[model samples]
Target: MTDAPALFLGQSDQPETLLLSRANRHGVVAGATGTGKTVTLQIMAQGFSEAGVPVFCADVKGDLSGICMPGSPNEKLLARAQEMGLALTPKAAPTVFWDLYGQKGHPIHTTVSEVGPVLLARMLNLNEVQEGVLSVVFHVADKEGLLLLDLDDLRSMLAYVGENAERIGREVGNVAPTSIAAIQRSILQLEQQGGAAFFGEPALRLEDMLRTSLDGRGQVNVLDATRLMNSPRLYAAFLLWLLSELFEQLPEVGDPDRPRLVFFFDEAHLLFTDAPDALREKVEQVVRLIRSKGVGVYFVTQNPADIPDSVLAQLGNRIQHALRAYTPSEQKGLKAASQSFRPNPAFDTAEAIQGLGVGEALVSTLDEKGAPRVVGRTKIRPPDSRLGPATDAERAQIMAASPVRGLYDTPVDRESAEEVLAARRGEADQAAADAKLAEARARADAAAAKEAEKAAAAREKEQVRLDREAERARAPARRSNRQTPVEALTKSVLRTAGSTLTRELLRGVLGGLKRR
Candidate 1:
């Protein structure tokens, strides 16, 4: 057991240590405020980094930033290390600072698509119905190939789904406008709480956080969550998102010699506080199954009861600092916490929990065969890094020299749901306008055809009038233009009678002339 891989935690009756072989089994660091939980976390982080295991943790109080700076250990710290039979080195771990707002260090970003609907619904605090609607929205986005990169993309997508709810609902499921509006309001609230900066392009790449120094020291990725604590849900959701990312992106190694990465979830209660049952189950499931991926998750909270029993059962290694039990509820919690550990039989575990001084904890970790060792009253080791936040100038210098210095610092606005939906709407509008113009042209054509018909009819009528006047001009003038057959015969007989009378008169006149 002497040469076995392990992290020296501190001195108990014997040397207290956490076997690195079982580090992937997951653990917890629980204590009240100012009970050396941060220090314990720092020591564990440094230990893992030294083992070439990358670490990710939130800087809630801004104190974890000191891991990037060398410590100025006081005499007391040095004496404690010597008493523990160890020579201490005050050197900083290789650390890279991160911030969601992009003010502290490298900006940590993730697409809305990556956040997905479930975690997003939890983040937005949506009810069941609203969450279902959100799931439908995600489905539609996926089907339509819309990339939801940021808040605007999500907002526009919601509007699109809301406007086309019936059609979309028939294809998928019911997307209530009220539910959509509620989710929208929740998004607005999240945006107001500064969540807009988190969902965008140039998202955080897991490889960057999982990097190790060229010298084989693990890189410590510290997220500046001091201001983020103002919105506890955001802080919790982000860390959980990172954990989920690690679980999904990393292949299952099935209990590697050491964890590929170590995640320290600070202020863990916010993850479960008012969280829905489904969400809690999701968190529990992730914690349970993510160990096979060789990533260790350590929850840092004020009390063990803050974690649901289902989740609490999964944490094997426990470093519980002192917890006060002034109230009955507190005492009940204390009893429950103490009973969770294997009884040492040296002293009452419950009594030892309350009587423990600062930097003192009941250390229990899994043995080489993956079994919880008996609890030990132990003095936790001091961190080799500084005990407080790093100076602003020092942080700036580190960030300037960061490996991912320029990668995620600037924001990227590529084409996504926002622009896609907008262009679709614009096209729709142009189509409508063209249709109206076509209808107007059709009406105009009909009017022009009717006018042409009327003009043709008038011209035909005028031509008929002109033909009648030409017929009058070509005809001979007579009082009666019609002829009768009886009148024509009577006129012929009169002409014959008159010719006979003339012939008789001419004969009588010729006879008288001859007699004379």
Candidate 2:
């Protein structure tokens, strides 16, 4: 039994330890500031690494980097170890450092698609309508086969959806322009808050985080969160995305002898603050179900009530440090925290919760049968590594030795939704110009045809007038010939008439005398 590995927490009436097999069931470390919560986390991380389980934790105060360096023997540490009857060793764990800003450690990034629209809307603090619009934008990008790799891709997709809202709304339901505008404003705000550095190609993979050292000890990955904590929403959203990614990618392993990886979330309150009911439910579900995938999640927060009850119920291990009961609300919280633990007969639970010293905590862990053991008042052991932040020179040496240094150091900008939409716009613009040119040529051809028809009509009219003048000139010659013929005939007729008249006169003189 002595050979079986266990995490040495501290002493109750006797020495107490946390079984490594049940670590995947999850746990919580709650305390007020200056209550030694960081030390408890460091000791646990060291234990998990020695058990050959990888550990991932956020470093909010920059102190956690010290875990990568060996500890110095101090009087207080030696006295505590002697009092607790522990053979304490001072040694450093194998560690890999990560930073979102790329200044303190290896840069970690995830594509916008992997972030998805639901978590992104939360990160941007979008309203319901804006969230719906963002979802529609993602839908459009997916349907069009556009890859959303970064912030620029998302922004371009938003613009494209807004410009074609009316057309797209017909097929994919209503997309309001006002909603699109609001989402755009939110994205711009996120960009200004260093969101651009978070979303891009060569995203982080879960395998990289689960690596073991050459000596068979697990690597402790410390995420530098000093700058990231400034943007609380971004920090929360990123952690949530990482959890969901692990849940989705890892296969079911049931309960193993030890977890494949252990994740510790610091400043855990931001994960639930202002989160919608749907998001909260999803988080709870992930916490409940991720255990089967051989991953344990530990939440480090200032208050016990910060975690939702559904999630808190899944935590099998509880290490609660001191809580200040100065105000009425704090006293009530103190009472609630006291009632949660399985009672210890040695002391009052409520009084112990408020009176626990800096390194003391009310600890309860799962037994071999998966039941909560009796609570014990424990003095947490100091970490085997340094208890403060690592120097810049030390951090630089660690990053230089990392195998993934070259993989994520240089950012890649592959073809994505932004480029695809720009090409589409270019093609559409060219098609419009071609149509306009064809319309103009048609108008010019019609005008030219009308002018030619008018010219042909005028030439035909001139020909008719010239023919009439020629006919008039020929009419005179015809008239002269006819007149000569008519005059000869008339003269002949007059001479015949004169001769007949002479005869008639002779006869008519005698007839006239008779008639008179």
In model 1, the Cα lDDT at residue 114 comes to 94
Q: Whole-model lDDT for model 1 versus the true structure? A: 0.92
Q: Which stretches of candidate 1 lie over 4 Å from their true place?
A: 456-516
Per-model TM-score on C-alpha atoms: 0.89, 0.88
lDDT accuracy of residue 65 in candidate 1: 94
Q: What RMSD does each model have against the real structure?
A: 6.6, 4.2
Give the alpha carbon lDDT tens digit for every residue of 95-127 in model 1. Answer: 999999999988889999999898898889888
**On residues 345-451, what C-alpha lDDT tens digit does candidate 2 reach at each position?**
88999999889999999999888878888999999987799999999999999888986778888998988998988888999999999999999999999999999
Report model 2's TM-score to 2 decimal places: 0.88
**Largest lDDT belongs to which candidate?**
1
Candidate 2 stretches with Cα past 4 Å from truth are 1-3, 448-516
For residue 495, give model 2's deviation from the true position in Å. Answer: 18
- What C-alpha lDDT values do all the predictions have? 0.92, 0.90
